[model samples]
Target: MAEVRAEMVANVWKVVVNEGDQVSDGDTLVILESMKMEIPVISEDDGVVAQLKVAEGDVIQEGDLIAVIE
Candidate 1:
């Protein structure tokens, strides 16, 4: 399993993948808003999305685990 973490502090602007979705290494999992910019959170390893720990509008800190892949 792999844990998807936030790269920086931001608000979850969108969730592009749902639980059970298959992903590739560079697949976009979520989009975050910070400093008026959108940032995409991507999977580090190919796997099925096992959990989504964040939602749209949720604020997250850097290094916070946002999703689980397995």
Candidate 2:
């Protein structure tokens, strides 16, 4: 399993994948808005999305878990 974490403090702008969705490495799972910039949070390995720890408009801090892949 892999834990996807936030790279910086930001608001979750969009969620691109949901639980049970399959994703490959580099595939964007969510988009975050930080300092007026959109940053994509990507998958590190091919796996099914086991959990989504955030939602649109939610504020997240650096190192916060964003999603879990298995």
Candidate 3:
């Protein structure tokens, strides 16, 4: 399994993938808004999305768990 994490403090702007969705490396799982900028959180592994740890409008800290790929 692979864990995707937040790299900065931000509010989740959108979620692009759902649990059980197939994902490729570099696929965007969520978009984040911080300092008025939109940032995409990309998947680092190709696998099924096992968990979504965030949602739109959620405020996340740096290093927070974003998703799990299995």
Largest lDDT belongs to which candidate? 2
The Cα error of candidate 3 at residue 35, in Å, is 0.4
What is the per-residue lDDT of model 3 for residues 1-70, given as tens digits with 9 covering 90 to 100? 9988988999999999999999999999999999999999999899999999998999999999999999
Candidate 1 lDDT at 60 equals 99
C-alpha TM-score for every candidate: 0.94, 0.97, 0.97
Choose 2 or 3, whichever is better by TM-score.
Answer: 2
Candidate order by TM-score, highest to lowest?
2, 3, 1
lDDT of 2 by residue, 27-67 (tens): 99999999999999999999999999998999999999999
Better of 1 and 2 by TM-score: 2
Q: What root-mean-square deviation over C-alphas does model 3 reach?
A: 0.6
Number of the top candidate by TM-score?
2
Model 1: how far residue 64 lies from native, Å: 1.1
The stretch of ten residues in a row with the least summed lDDT in candidate 2 is 3-12
User: What local distance difference test score does each model get?
Assistant: 0.94, 0.97, 0.95
A best-first ranking of the candidates according to their lDDT comes to 2, 3, 1
| Candidate 2: stretches off by over 4 Å | none
- For candidate 1, report its TM-score: 0.94
Error of 1 at 34 (Å): 0.3
Candidate 1 on 1-70: residue-level lDDT in tens?
9998988999999999999999999999999999999999989899999999998999999999999999
